[model samples]
Structure formats: C-alpha cells, structure tokens
Target: MKGLYCRADAADAQPKFVIQETSLPEVLGSHQVRVQVKACGLSPLDFKVPKSVVDGCYQFKLSDKKIENRIAYWCEYKYEWLSVCLYVRPKPEKLSSVCVAAALRDALCAYTALHTHARMAVGHTLLVMDGASSFGLMCIQLASYHGVRVLTTSHSLQKHTFLEQLRPSVARVIQVYNGSSDLLPIVLEETGGLGVDIIIDSGVRLQEEEELKETKCLPHKHELISALGVGGHWVTSHQDLQLDPPDCRLLHLKSASVSFLNPETWTASSAQQGRYLHILKDILEKMAAGVLRPQPEDAVSLYEATVAMETVQHNQRKKAVVQL
Candidate 1:
C-alpha cells in the first residue's frame, strides 16, 4: 500500500511528510477491509500538530504496524477509510472513483460529538459559541437536519457571509455573529432571553477569557457562561470540566450541565466505533441528497500529496484531498 508519512529526522527539525510504499495485510479480518485508496482528506491539524498527538486515530486503529500521522481520509477503524470505502454504498464506479464519497466521511467527528455528548432535540436552539470552527460548522448543519434551530458565532466578519452561504437551506440558521467575544448577550436576546438549549465551544470552554486578562474580558466570559439556558447543555473540548465559581453557580441555579468532549476519543469504545460507521454512511447519503455540504476537494495525485497537505496547513479550512 502507498501512504504519506511524517518523517522527523532530527529532534530539532520540524517533521515533513513524504510519500512511501507501505506493506499491508492481504486477508480481510472479517471486520477489516482495505479501501482502495481513493480520496484522502487533509485537515489543518495534519500539518499544525505533531504526529504523536494523532497516532491513535489511524496508526493504532487501522494498521498493526506503526504509521505516521495521516488519518480522516488523508486516510483508520478503530480508522476505516482504507481503499474499501470506495463503494461502501451504491454508486457508479466512475463517479465513486472520485474522492467525493470519501471526503464526506470527514464530517463524522463533528456529527458524532454533538449527538453523543449534547442533549439536543428537535425545535431546540443551540448557540455554537465557536461557529467558525469545523466542528461548529458541521454541528449547525446536522442540527438543522433534526429540525433544530442553530445560531452560530464567528469572530471573522468574512466568515459570517461564508457560513450563511455554506449553510444548507433546510438548516434553520438563525444567526451568524461577527465577533467571538461579546456574543452571549446577543445570543440570549436572539433566543428571547430563554438562552439556547445547547452551547458548543469548539476549543476549551471560555478560551478567550484566558487570552485577554483585563476587566473587559471578564464580561465576555461571563456572558458566554450566562448564555447557557436554564438547564441547557454546554459541551466543549477541555481537559477540565470545572468552571469558575460564578459560572458554576449560574449553571447550578439554572440546572444546566457541562461536559467535555474530544474528537480524538471518538473511537474509544466499541459502541462509539459502531456509531461512527453508521454516521459515515448517513453523511454520504446526505451528500447525495444535497442536504449536507461536501468539502470542496482540491484533489491531488500521489506526487502532489504534499501540496494538498500544505494547502490545509497554510490556509485554514479549505479542503484538500489526495486521490490514489
């Protein structure tokens, strides 16, 4: 099998990825399938983070032999996008030969996190505190599919229009904010002061609070905490689920719940592993139905694989795929 790998020859040198031929298993393990490498998705983390941080997603799950970081379709089971996903569902070989189907599976992480961790329901509204993020973007769309109203915040003014345009018509996208901080009050007002049913912070909860250590920043953090409706569910990726005393008291009085979730832990348990596959199938179906937006694939050949990865690293969220 051919794979792109990160090689760090020296401790002081930054890791660089290069294509190399890899040896893989021949027989299927009943549960395993070797997806003919079709499309490989590139995430910003592909180049941004170190390989060790991501080893578990693909290296440990898919191949018994150690593989350098490159998963999500930059292609896992325990990571499944091996070449076999080419025809996981019905498809014309010509059309399926392209990377679109494999690219759609990239959404599984965000979708899985929201469904399992957030106690969301139809007709409910969620204030995605970090809307510009990949997870928040997908959450908005999937929630809309369930008939839930979504209000998202993106500090980037440029992204405001992009998000609105990117959102599917079926998604009841209620609002898109222009700034990250000073958003909770507007969020509360938008929901008629009831606050949102769920709040998803893409980074650690109240990460902005740690950035600016001034009196002005406290209100931003306070408003963020206050935006969680009475009994609303708050979910984010953080090592600590603890909150400041004031925020803690407010959530307590409101009977809201706070939970920490990590996409890295998506395949942690067997039950979650099963659910991940189901979600991937559904995402492919939705892409076919035009409900879910597909990543604009900057398809590259094996030799150009590094270029695709560079695109993801240099540019923030643009989707780049390497076709094998």
Candidate 2:
C-alpha cells in the first residue's frame, strides 16, 4: 500500500513517503471499481508540483493529513451522480524513458487533434508543426491510423528521415531551420496555394527579450499564420501563445480559428472518462491477447494504489495508480 508523494524541493525530486500508506477508500456504489494502477507516466508538470506547493504560491491545499496519502489524478466526479476512471500501463524502470513519454504525448496529441482542434474526417489533411517530438510524431501516426493525410515538418533532416520511416501515412515531410520564414513559400506551393487544413504549432517560441529579437529574425510564426486556409484551425501548446493573442490579425481577417490547449483543462468528463477506461481496457486486452503488440515487454509497469492532490499545477505530468 505504499504510494508516491511529491517533495517540496527540486523539480525532479523523487517521490517521498506519505504519513499513511495509500489505499482505496470504501466503494460508495456499484459504479466504481478500485483499480490497481499498473503504470503511470511522468509529465513535465510532475516535476513542477514540488516548487508550487512548497512556495505557498499554489492556490489549492489539503490538510497535511489528507494529501499526506492521496493525490488527485485527472479523473474526477462532476455532479454527484457521475464519476470517472482511467487505466494506464506503467513505464518500466529500465526502458528508454522517452518511449513512454512519447506514448503519452501521442495519446494527448491524438486526443487533442481528433477531439479538440480539427475533426478527423476520413480524407482530411493534417499539418503537424515540429514533427520530430514524441507528441508530434505520435500525432502523425494516430492521424494516419484514422485515415487522415499528414504533413509534418522537422528542422533536422535526419529526424525527418526517421519520422518518414515511422509514419508511412505522412504525405510529405519538410525540412527547415528552426524559425525559418523562407519555408512558408515552399509549404504553400506544395499545398497548391490553398493552404493546409490544420496547423499544429508545437515548436518553442522565443520569449521576453529573446522573443523581441525572434520577432525580427524569425518568420516561422508569420508563415504559419499565412498558411492556414480560411476556416482551417491552428493549435499550439505554447504558454505565451495561450496567454496573449497572436501578433497577426489574420485569424480574424480570414475567419480562421486558433486554439490553445492548457493541459490543466484536460480532465475527462464523466462519460468521457468512462470511454477512456474502456479504450485502455481494450488496449490492455489487445496486448494480452497478442493482437496489439506492445513496443517491448518491459515498456511499462503497473502500480498498486492511488494518491490524492488538492490542485495540481497547470503543466506537469505525474505518475499514479488506479487500485482495482
């Protein structure tokens, strides 16, 4: 029944012991199952929780006694009648950590693009910016799995070659320097000047004083904005992009839509949570049956208990369990 707890020190500080061993609370009704967590993945946000809570900057707090044993996962109940549960495989201690992080990144990108940004119709084209990251590459694979044509970009020629091997569904791959504005013309030409159906901006944008310099030097932002067709969508995970409006007025001019994913708002709804669990069950069952092969035998691990948190910060990912 031992569980993980965030320490109030460095971002990557390891989990510490809670005052009490973690355990499932008594089941309130038939709708719930005490899931034993098999594996939980660490996210960037997971590393940030310690500082926020310890600094007294965090808005949410539980009695030292309550959170001493529990931290809330994304699943939660809205109305008293509803509840949610998610099942995930744990990462193994020895495998490449990037692979598991990539899996979650794929899940997030796939879910976000499929459900949030552009509806994935059978033949639609998806343009993924920064296509080399685990999230971007996974987005390409998932979009292709659903029959969407994917166009992705990478600054690394070598990485582009690697991605091409990974995603046969990618219709085209473009190589450019980071923040290169010159590539926009090439992108527009390749797409027949009509523009792409969707643009995913996953690259890092310069900020503060550096950002001002980038504005003068980089044309990727401008080119990206220009390349969206009317009614097409642009999506980004950039925090500054989320907080402030894009510099260009083209979205308003072209009636295009822009969306920012604040992973903080990523909690599943009651019904959606049910669906998520069902999907995970199917994934696990497939792996068990050897129908859907796992990347490797030691790809992930499973955990035994749940931890509760009052309010997790905006962008970190943490590992936890669903005790069944």
Candidate 3:
C-alpha cells in the first residue's frame, strides 16, 4: 500500500510528509472490512497536529466481494487499502463521494456535540466559536434547522458578514480580530445579559489570559464560562483544557455543565458502536435530503496531498480532500 507518510524529526517543529509504501495488514477482524481509498479529508486536526492520520471516507470491497461505502479514520497513512472497524454506513447515492469525504466526520462531530452532548432544542440559543470553519458552519446549519438561534464567531470580518447573511438568519456574527475581546461581550448583549444556552468551542486558551495577535487565537476558559447562561451546556474540543478555581466557581454559579466532544469514543467503546453507525446513517440521509451539507472541498491529487496538508495547517483553506 502506498500512503502519505509523516516522519517526525526532533530537530524541527513541523513534521515532513512523503509518499511511502507500507505493508498491508495480514489479518482482519471478523467485523472489519478492507476499503479502497476514494477520497481523504484534511482538517486542522490532521495537519496542525504532529500525528499522522488519514481522516477519510471511501468506497470499499470486502474479501467476500460485498460492497460498502465507509467514512474512516486511521493513523499513519494518507491513502491505500484500509482495515476499518464496523464504523461503516451507507453513503447517500445523491451526495458526491468527495463531499462525503470532506464533511462526514465534521458533520458527525457537530451532530453529536449539539444533539447528544448539548441536548440542543428549538428556540435554544447557541454560540459556535470558529464559526467560519466547516465544522462550525455545520453546527450553525444544524442548529438553525432545528429552530435554534445562533450566535457565531469568525476570525475575520469578511466571514462574519457571510455568516450573518446565511438563510434562516444568524442572530449575530462576532468577529475576533487578532486577539480582540469580542466574543463574550457580544454573546451577552445578544442574549440580553442571560448568555447563550449552548456554547461549542473548537479550542480554548489553557493558561495564558494575555492576548496574542495571532489569527487563530483561542478564547480564554474564563470567557467561555462567563458567557454561559444558567444551566448552559459547554461542549469543547480542547482535550488538554484545564479549568481554574474561578472558572469552576463560575460554572457552579450558573449551574452549567461541560462535556468533551470526542467523536473517536464511539469507535473506542463497544457499547456505543451501534449508535455510531446509526448517526453516520442519519448524517448521510440528512445530506441527501438537503437538511445537511458539507463544506466546500478543495480537491487535490495524491501527489499534491503534502502541500494541501500544509495549507490546511496554516488555515489557508476551509477544507481539503485527497481525491484518488
């Protein structure tokens, strides 16, 4: 199998990727299937992080000659034959394969975070940080579909404007400019000082309260807790996030709860596997019905995957997919 391999070097911070040949697995689990790669999705998590992961969706052919279309996440390779667990679900015939590859996981993340973790309902107020990204956009659309009022934040004014004009309309689009303190204030103001019912954040500032003029500067933990209304749900992707005593006190005061949005848990635990496949099916059906749509794909060949991955890490593209 030929794959885009990432070799980490201690001398440099960035990992270098190259196409390399690796041996296929000799054995497969009873429930596992070997899939031929069709397209692989690239996001900040795949590129910015040092780990090598092919976050992909594909059309497959098993040993028994049975056919399936699957969206998979596996480490250490970009594309090739993959032995994936039963995370398989039927891809909607109406949706393009590249679209599924580019958006499936992110859409699943949004769905699980909002519906499962947050318990989002119609008329609920939602605050989605990093609202311009594919995941963010999906969160907005899904929430809006259920009649929730959405207040989203974008890194730039241009994206903020675009989000404001979205159909069904966004409640507000707050622009965070180079560490500007805009999110909390705007969220509070729009919600009439009550704050939002749900907050979905990609990442948060762990230690530093000091502002940095970086483009992708994350919100401070303090700000996140402060913007939660009473009994609010705060869903975060910040796995390493730590909360201070003050942060805890604020959440306590508001009777707010927090949940980590780790989609991989479904695959890691046996009990949730059935639910995982069900959700995958629902997401595909929604896309077919026009209730859900993926982010625009910047398609690249296998040869150009390395450069495309770099571009994703730098936030130069919304979403990138390796099309085979």
Candidate 4:
C-alpha cells in the first residue's frame, strides 16, 4: 500500500518523511485490527513512525472483534488503507469523518488532562494556558460544558479576542506578552487571591536561563506553583520536565499535585486498552450530543498531505486532516 513513510539511514539520524509506497505486514498481531482509510489527522506523531499509527477516522475492514463496517477512530493512510493495532468504536452519525478525525485525539488529551489527571469538578476555576491551541480549545470547551469556570491565556490580541468570544464565554482571557510576569497576578486577581483550582499548561519553563519565547508560551514553573490554589492539580504535557527541591517544597506546602499528561499509556499498557476504548466512546457521544465541539481545522486532499504535514510538524498548524 502507498502511504507516508519516514526514511532514515541510521537509527540516530533525523527521520525524513516522504510520501511513497510502503507495505504492511501480511500477518496481523493477535490484538490488531485492519482499518480502511477514510481520513487521517495530521499531528507531530504522524511525522515520526511508531509501532502503530492510531490517530484518524477509518472504517474497520477486518478484526477478530467483529467490528466491520463500523466507522471508528484513529489510523494513518495515504492513497490506500493501513492497519492499526488498536481497537475501535463506532463513529458518531451526526458528524462527518473528517470532523470526527480532527476532534477525537485532542478531545481525548483534554479529557485525560482535566478529568483523569486533574480531577476537575464543577464550580472549580481552571487556568488553561495557550487557549488558542487545539488542545487548549478542547480543554476550555470541556471544562465550560462541565460548569467549571475557565480563565485562559493568549499571546496575541487576536487569540485573546477569540477566547473571549467563545460561545460559552471564558471567565477571563489574559493577554500575555513575551517576558511578562503578568499571568500570575491576573490569575490571582480573578480568583480573589486564591489562585485557580486547576492549572493546565502545554509546557512549563523549568530553568532561570530559559528565554521567553513566543512560540511555545511555556509558563514558568514557579508561576504555575504559585498560581495553584490549595489542593489544586497541575496537568502538564512537558515530558522531560524536571523539578528542583524548591519546586517540590512549594507544591507540598500548598498540597498541590503535578501529573504528566501522557495519552500513550492507554495504548502502551495492556490493562488500559479497555478504558481507552471507553474514553473514545464517551468522546464521540459527547460530540454527538453537542457537549463537545471539534476544533477549527484545515482539510487537505490526500496528495497534499505530504506538504501539509510540515505545517503540523513545525507547530504551524494544530489541526490539519488529510481527507482520502
């Protein structure tokens, strides 16, 4: 089958992704499912090959589980179908395939970060950093739907305005300038000096030497700790994050907990696969009920996926889906 392939001369060398003919194993694993391509979500994950490619909307062609003809979530492809090792859930009838493809993974990440890791509850105040991001947008919407008050940060006036104009309307949209320390103060003011009940950041700056860059909008670790209310939870996506003794002491004093948001655990560990499928089902149901909305996306044709992928790879676009 023809698909997007990552070519590398050495294991340590950088992967060069190209659209070309590739082949899948004729044999399927015991737990594997073969998914016929419908559409593929463009993500950084797509730029690097994995043991399995599991984010896209597709139809089940063959599986021991007998889910054939069911439109489901997650898999990658080009001109032809590809195989996915993960399980499947029926796609929502109310939404198109591309729409479902764009929303599923981000919704999963948001749900895992807020509900799973942070244990978000109604009436709690949430500070979502970078509200313009697709994942951040999902976090805001899901929290808003659950009656949680949301305060989000934006780096530009346009993004700030967009966050303010959301249908449910964010409680506060704070514009953050580079090298500015205004976020903590604004968050404190909004919460009447108690800080927010939950803090979700895309990443956090852990060192003093780190430059204030506009690309990532990483909140300083100290600020995040200070911004958390007593007994609050901080959900972070930073994988290589490190904490110093002072960082630990501050968190301990406030009884705040930090949990890394790793969605791969669902597929990596065998015990979590059942729960993963359940989450997918819940996400689709929420989408069907209009409780969760898909993020804004730019759709591209299958042939255009080769170039469109770079946009997602370099973080130029958050939600780009390849329609087959």
Off by over 4 Å in 2: 8-34, 46-105, 178-181, 204-219, 242-248, 263-324
Order of the predicted models by TM-score, top scorer first: 4, 3, 1, 2
- TM agreement with the true structure for every prediction: 0.68, 0.60, 0.81, 0.84
Total clashing residue pairs per candidate? 11, 30, 0, 2
lDDT preference between candidates 1 and 4, better one: 4
Candidate 2 TM-score, true structure as reference: 0.60
User: Local error of candidate 1 at 26, Å?
Assistant: 7.9
- Top lDDT model: 4
Write model 2 residue lDDT over 49-139, tens digit each, in one string.
Answer: 2222223211222222311211124432222232333333433333333333325434554566555667667866678876766567657
Q: What ranges in model 1 sit over 4 Å off?
A: 8-14, 23-34, 44-106, 129-134, 164-181, 204-221, 238-242, 307-319
RMSD of each: 7.0, 9.5, 5.2, 5.1
Model 2 clash tally, residue pairs: 30
- The most accurate candidate by TM-score is 4
Residues 82-142, model 1: lDDT tens digits: 2111124433232343445334544565575567777578778777744555556667677
Error of 1 at 10 (Å): 9.2
* lDDT tens per residue, model 4, 1-324: 778764555556655668887777787877565677777777775323344433433233454454543555544332233434445678767788888878888999999998889989888999999988888888998999889999999877788778878846598888775556689899999999998989999788877567755434677888899999999999988777898899899999999999988675565445566777888888889999988887667679877887787666666666588888
